[model samples]
Target: MDDQDILMVSEAQIAESFDADGLMLKPLTLFIKTEHPDVIERELSVLGFFSISTSTTPEKTPMYEFTLSPLNT
Candidate 1:
């Protein structure tokens, strides 16, 4: 791994790695566009990470704070 190199991985790579087992990705905080936080939880679970906790936000806004686990190597 290169030092100080953090790649914003494409969704394709994330999915491929899910099946193919490529280099690992660090945990991420994705700000999903939605009023509902549950969707982020579900999506992250599908993406192979557990949701730690969500920050408080107004229901009308689409941005949700989701902390997920590191990607599986």
Candidate 2:
């Protein structure tokens, strides 16, 4: 499969999703977003060595992000 497809499949496998009010993203989530931003940017951008996005709700504001690179990447 293409890289984008691979990324989508991988995210699906992990069942990762963020709530509008969530404060933190799990390590695995950050790692995946970091490693796959180029392939995944068609939908979202993973910034600051991890995927970062503003909350759709004004109350949520900025969201802190984190991630660890895969051993194989």
Candidate 3:
């Protein structure tokens, strides 16, 4: 994969909020430029993220949205 195909997540890119139940929620929005977005989705699932939605940018780049919460919550 070229450098442009690699997805990088910065600390500032991660957003945290609390649900109504006071559960901490981490939401992520990733615009995948790679041809195989499933690989990225699987990786995120391994990290405990739940797939929220999947879409595409105006340019047709795959876009994935995910959310993660504490296992206890």
lDDT of each: 0.51, 0.34, 0.53
lDDT of 2 by residue, 8-55 (tens): 125552445333553333435332323344444434443434443321
Candidate 2 is scored at a TM of 0.21
Minimal lDDT window, size 10, model 2: 55-64
Q: How are the candidates ranked when ordered by lDDT, highest leading? A: 3, 1, 2
| Superior by TM-score: candidate 1 or candidate 2 | 1
Worst 10 residues of 1 by lDDT: 1-10
Backbone Cα, N, C clashes tallied per candidate: 0, 1, 0
Name the runs in model 2 displaced over 4 angstroms: 1-5, 9-20, 29-46, 49-73
lDDT of 1 by residue, 1-73 (tens): 2223122335864564344554445544545555556655766577655435566446564556665555442
Candidate 3 stretches greater than 4 Å from native:
1-4, 8-26, 60-73
lDDT of 1: 0.51
* Predicted candidate 3 versus true structure: per-residue lDDT over 3-73, tens digit per residue: 35545455454544545665546555555566666676677668653544455556645443333444543
User: Candidate 1, after superposition: displacement of residue 23 in Å?
Assistant: 3.5
User: How many Å off is the CA of 59 in candidate 1?
Assistant: 10
